[model samples]
Target: MNASTFTTRFRAAMMPTVPSPLAMLSHGKGARVWDVEGTEYLDFLGGIAVNALGHAHPVFTRAVSAQAERLAHISNYFASEPELALAERLTRLTGGDAVYFTNSGTEAIEAAVKLARRTGRPRILSLTGSFHGRTMGALSLTGKPVLQDPFRPLLPGVEQIAPTIAALEKALADDVAALVVEPIQGEAGVVDLPDGYLAAARELTSRHGALLILDEIQTGIGRTGDWFVYQAEGVLPPGAAPDAVALAKGLGGGFPIGALVGFGAAAQLLQPGQHGSTYGGNPLATAVAGAVLAEIEDAGLVANAALRGAELRAAIAGMASPLVAELSGRGLLIGVVLTRPVAKEIVAAAQERGLIVNAAAESRVRLAPPLIIGDAEVAEFTEKFAAALAAVAASTPTGATA
Candidate 1:
């Protein structure tokens, strides 16, 4: 069907949380997708940075199919080998002592919040412009009030702090149980943390006896060249780490899954019956995640992401298109800020030319292509992007800064 029909049918019944169009995905492979109209587009969005190994990856297909045949789910009342294996892998890779799986990123954040509050502290600190999730609890931590205005009186004691030392000192206190911060604020048009920000936040929270919860929902799972941006940025000390980490988006290679990892002292915070899920770590999702992680190593996808990421960013920046105001982000997660507010036009133009990109903000065009994107695709997208920017510049209102 077309965008109009899809929107008309779904928007009426669905909760209007996200302004999503009903352009149904017919199929996807590698870094591209075909809509129901059979129109193919280069998928730079990558399912909002969730398709880590790209669409329909062989490893993901095989692992999920094979696990489905053996067993689907048996709940937490019983144990599954794949689930245990996935947990061990995450703990080993992340150095977290334990993990709690959820069905999506919002749920993972909820678990982390619970872990922080389990210590009897009630306050939480989060950064401005950060997009945590739409859940009521997570929504309280999100800085954007647009998402929270309709659902007022969110969880009490949630504080939104300006990304400044002065603000942290003023707002957070010993009674604060957690400080959640995104390594790179993706939905804030791919904003990166200032140098020494995360480290100082970690220290301040520790001093106050509050847990430092790193929200890696977007920047984890090899999206930032490294497994997690915190590792590459050197935020964690030799022995110290975040009390807990929330992960999702790219963890399962498009197979839905999220994780809350509690490390060291934080591990025992969530005791039995404190938190559980029916399909969080079921065989299919864990098997897929485990397979994707293994395949990323075997196929050298992580290294490829580093190399290709650099190349892609350089190409986007080098164009020096008049409309492009700035280029930001690490690894495959890059954002191009425009001189004017024509993000909708740019996105629509790119779509018409069989390219897919996302308008993250009024003047920011974010590019989160698949990890397996080749040089040819990069070149193709760059050319189309330049043209799209030119068109936006020519037709839109005159320049104003991003």
Candidate 2:
């Protein structure tokens, strides 16, 4: 079926808040996908950074099937090997001592909020342009007014500060329970927080006894050239480790999973019965996460992510198109800034050329391809991206930039 037909059917079947379905995706392999009508496209969005190992990796599929055959899920009252192993591994990776599993990124944020509140402090601080999640508690922490305005009277005591050291230091108060910041603002047009600002936040939070929470839902799981974005030396400054970290997106390698890792004293905040999820650490999901981690280690995708990410950025920069103003973000998560507010036009043009990209803002085009993307895909993407730019420039008004 065509996209229009699928959109019509989907609109009738699903809730109205969801935007129109882009396409009736039939199947995907590696870094490419096909729509229901069999039209092919290179998938740069990577399921919005959730496909860590890309589509249908053999190890991932095998692990899921094997775990399904043995067992699927049990209540939080019961313990499972996969769940335990995955939690242990994640904690080790993040320099944390404890973990709480959830079904998605938003749930992870919600759990983190509750953990922060347990400190008895009533206020939480987040950076402006932050996108934690859509749930009421997570929405309360999000800095975007458009998302929070509709959900008015959100959980109280959450305030936003700028992504700068001065703003953070000025806004911090004794009543603050935690300061949540994304190392790289993915939804806010791939904006990266200054390293010194992060360092200042750590020092100040330490002094004020407020927990530091890093939201790595988009930048984690090797998406940003590191196991976790904070793992990269110099990203968070010396002696700077967040008290709590929320993770999801690519953690399960496509299976639904998320985790909140608490370090030091914050680890003991959430005791038994304080928080839980029905499918948080289900055997199936945890098994897939374990396999995803194993695959990343064995195949050296983390290093590959670093290498390819640099190459992608350099190539785009070398294009030297006047319409291409700049590029933001690291690793597979990138944003191409246009000289004007032509991101929507560029995205449509790229789609017409069988390349999938997202318009993160009016002038920002975001690309979050799979970590496994390589030279051939990069070359093809660059060529198509240039073509998309040419298409835009040709049709744009003579006085305006594409």
Candidate 3:
């Protein structure tokens, strides 16, 4: 069926929780996708940073198929080889001692919430401009009110503070269980934390006897040119590591998977019968994630993400457009700040020009293209993005600000 027919069916059958369909995508390969009508577009958004290897990667395909044929689901009662291997890999990558798998990023956050609760402390602290997830526990920890207001009476003992050392120092105490933070706040216009903020947070949280959890759902799995942002140089001081980390998005590439890795004493937070998931660590999902991570390592895509990201940033800056305010974020994750609140307009213009991007906020356009993108993808992106910016600038009135 055509995209229009699917759209009609979608609106009729689906709940109104989210907006109507943009386009009914048919298939994708690498960083490009096609609609039902066979129109192609460059997928700069990369499924909101979930498609680390892009769509339909050979490694992903082979892993899923082969694993399905061998062993798909054995439940938590029986341990699988893939599950154990993936767990070992994740713990090693994050320098953690243990792992708990889940089905999505929010689930990982939920697990983290439980871990914090196990500390026997009264409160959990997050930043004001943070976005953790939408589940009750994760949503409660999320700083934005718009997303949390509807679901009032959310999990108690959760509070938010400004993303600064001063704010954290004032808010933290012996009563606080954990402080959850993102290395780079993806949902908040891809905002980065202040320099040395993580290190200082580590010191303060340690002194206060609180767990410092890093939510790397969007920034982990080589998205920021490192296995995880905490491992990135200058992000955290030497020998400093988060007590626990929440991971998802790119972990299974395009597949659905999430994990919580805990370090030191935090690793033993969840005792038996405290929490469980029916399909959390299934063999199929673990096998796919294991393959995806391995391919990312073998292909040196982490280095590619770092190099290509730098090149893309340079090229965008070279445009020197009056509308361009500045660039935020690092590696494949990028945010284009505009002088005016025309991010939605820019997104529409780019879509019309056969490119895909996301308006992270009123004045910010986010780009998270596939990690495998090379010079060709970067060139195409800059050309189309330049045109889109020009189109928006031409349409907007002067002296506009947001």
Candidate 4:
């Protein structure tokens, strides 16, 4: 269907909560998509960082195709082999005891949050500027109130703490259940907690009888230089791993999958029937996720993300354009914060020049190209991005706030 037709159908058939422009879609394939009019552009956004191997990878296409042919879904009434296999892979990757799959990252967070609260505690703490899914339970743990205000009286007993030992200590209480934080805050313009931040959080949470919940949905499964950023950071802090980790985004590659993993005693916290989902642990999604995991390992996409991401950051930082004030993030998730709020305009401009990027916030642009993106794509984006920024600069004052 054309973008306009789908857009019209969306207006008629779907909820009106999300913005209109976000509803438009046409077609997608590895790092590229075409609008309704058949306009082609590089897909650096990667379905908001969901495209692990990029669009239309033969393996992804074949995996989904084979699964659909074998069995599209089984309603979670029976155990699925593909799902179990995927779970085993995840458990191995996580170095954890048990795992529960979910339809999306928010649901994964919901499972984690509920498991934390089931401990008979009344309080849980998450960091500010974190974006968990929009479900009521997931939304409850989310720190952004603007997104949650419309649906009031959220899952209560949530307290937000800054990224500091002192703040975490102050928020910890006798009745606290868990503390949730993103290794690198993705939605908040890709802001990262400073070094040793996670290590310290683990220590304090342990000291206070609270569970440490690390949201790696955006940063896990080889999106960052590591399979799980917390795993890499765990060694830095010289301590044990986090109690629970929520992973999604790149886990399923382009398929819909998310996981909530718990280690040791925390793994036993989520007993059978305590939580479940219809579409979760299906053969299709898990098989695709397993394929993605295999690809990441076989192709070394994680190391690719690491080295290529460094090259990208260096290129962005090296650009003499006065618009670029700073650069941050690891792996393929790079954030280019401009001096002004011209992020949206820059993204639009990049698209016009045959590139795709995202304006994460008003002031920053987040580029999450597929992990398999190569030097060719990166080089093209580098030149085109410079041209786009120069175009913006030429049209406006040099030091004008973006």
Candidate 5:
């Protein structure tokens, strides 16, 4: 069917919770995707940063096929080799003692919530402008009121504080169970926390005996040039570590998977009967995720992410578009600040010019191309994005603000 036909069908059948599909994508390769009508576009959003290895990489394909033929699901009642191996790999990467598998980032946050509750504390804290997830527990932790207002009466004792050391210091106490934060606020226009804020958080949480949970769902799996942003240099103080972490997004490289890694004491919080998932840790998902992570490590994609990210940022800055304000974020996760609140217009223009990106906010454009992106992809993106910026700048009125 044509893209328009599919869009109509999608809107008719789908709930109103989310907007209709932008286009009916047929397939993708490396860092590009094609719509059903055969229009090709450079994909910088990378399925919202879930397509770590890009679309249909040979490694991902082979692993899925092989694992499907061997085994897919055996339920949590029985263990599998892939499941065990992935668990071990995750622990090693995060320096955590245990892992709890889930189907999405929000589920991972829910697991973290239960862990905090296990501490017998009454309060759980999350930073303002943080986006955890959409589930009840996660939504409660999310600081955006627009998302939480409809789902009122959220999980109690969850409060949002400004992303500052002083705010955290004021909120943290013996009654506080955990403080959840994102290294870079992806939803809040890819905003970065204050310098040494994480180190200070670690010290303060430790003093109050509260768990410091890093929500690295969007930044994990080498998206930000490291396995997790917490591992990035200068993020945490020397010899300091978070009590737990929530991971997803790029973890399965486009497949659905999430995990909560608990370190040291936090590892023992969730008892066996406390949490479980029928599809969690299944062979197929875990096997595919294992393959994705393996390819990322073996191919040196982590280092590639670091290198490519810097190059991409330079290319964008070199354009010197008047509408371009500045850039934020590290590695492949980038945010382009615009002089005007024309991000949506830029996205539409870019899509028309065979490029795909998204607006993180009214004035901020988010770019999350695959780690495998190289010179050709960057050049293509630069050309199309420049055209997009020009198109929007021509149409937007002066002094536009969101």
Candidate 6:
């Protein structure tokens, strides 16, 4: 069956919340993917920033293949070498004392919230416009009222404040178990937090004895030009670090793996029976994650993400279209703000031209291209994106121009 036929049937059987299928993807290579009909498209979305090495990198393939042949699944009761090695590597990368692996981003957040609860402080603080996860516990910390209000009476004791030093200080004056913030807000249109804001969070959380949890699910693992966006010098005050971090999207490079990393005293909160995951760190997932990390390090993809991201952002902004108002975010995670509410139109036009983009909001188009994207890919995307913007402008009705 083709995409339309399967999509119709699938939607009938599955939840209605899933977006209409863009295409029945069949295979991929490098930074490109093909649908069942053999149409190729540049994968600018990168599975929503999950594919770190891009599609089908040799190293990723070899490592996953070898590990699959040996061992793929084992209960948490029996630890494997790959799982231990992966956890150790992640903790070292984040300067955390220990880690608890899970199966997805939301799971990582749940584990982190649980760790916060272990503090017995009775309250958690988050920033306005934050997007932690959709699970009940995480939904409590998510600041978007629309997403939270629908499921009212959410986990209580979760408060949200404006993402500023003054607001943070005011909130911290009260008893709190943890203060969670994303180094860069992804779902809220790739909003980058100010560096001093993060430093302030570290200082205040420390002062209040509240754990500082940086939700790096979208910005971690070289997506933001660094191993972790929090690692950017000057982003954190001297001798300061987050008490915990939630990681997932890019950690496994398309494999399903997530982690909750706890630093210093925060590491000792969880006991053996307090929390667990059945398939959280199975051998296959950890092996793939380990390979993903190795490829990122060996290929210098981190530096490449930085250089290419700057180039792409500059090129897009340089277009100077009246419809293109501005750009936000860093590295491969970018948000294009438009003068009009035509982001959905732009996304459709880009897809028609064999490019994938995301409409993060009515006027914001988000691009989280693979970290392995290069100069040629960036140039091609810029050309197509400009064309998409022009298409949207031409289709606009009179008096709708902004």
lDDT of 2 by residue, 1-402 (tens): 777788889989998987886778899899999998998999898889999888988988999999999999997889999999999999888889899999999999999999988999999999889999999999999999999998799998899888889888788888999999898999988987875767788889999999999999999988888888777887677656899999999898899999999999999999888888888899999999999988888999888888988998898888787788888888888989888788888889998999999988888889999888988999999999989988987888756753
Report the lDDT tens digits of candidate 1 across residue range 1-402: 787888787889899866877267889999989998898888999999999888898888899889999998888788889889999999987888999999999999999888888989878889999999989889999999887899998999888988877788787787888899998889988987787787788788888888989999988888888887777757666566888899999889899999999888988998888888988888888988999888877877777778888988888788887788777888888878778777888998888888899999988888888778888888888888877777777777674655
Per-candidate TM vs. native? Answer: 0.96, 0.98, 0.99, 0.95, 0.98, 0.97
Instruction: Supply the global lDDT for candidate 4.
Output: 0.84
Specify the poorest-scoring 10-residue window by lDDT in model 3: 1-10
Pairs of colliding residues, candidate 6: none
Rank the candidate models, highest TM-score first. Answer: 3, 5, 2, 6, 1, 4
Clashing pairs for model 2 are none
TM-score of 5: 0.98
Which portions of model 4 miss their true places by more than 4 Å? 1-13, 22-25, 233-236, 398-402
Top lDDT hit: 3
What is candidate 3's lDDT per residue for 1-402, written digit by digit as tens?
786799789989999888877888999999999998898999999999999999999999999999999999988888999999999999888899999999999999999999999999989999998999999999999999999999999998999999998998899999999999998999988998999899889999999999999999999999988888889888787998999999999999988999999999999999999999999999999999999999999999999999999998999998887788999898999988889999999999999999999999999989999999998999999999999988888889969986
Model 4 residue 225 distance off true place after TM-score fit, in angstroms:
1.2
Relative to the true structure, candidate 6 has a C-alpha RMSD (angstroms) of 1.5
lDDT of each: 0.86, 0.89, 0.93, 0.84, 0.92, 0.89
Q: Pull out the clashing pairs in model 3.
A: none
Runs off by more than 4 Å, candidate 2: 398-402
Clashing pairs in 5: none
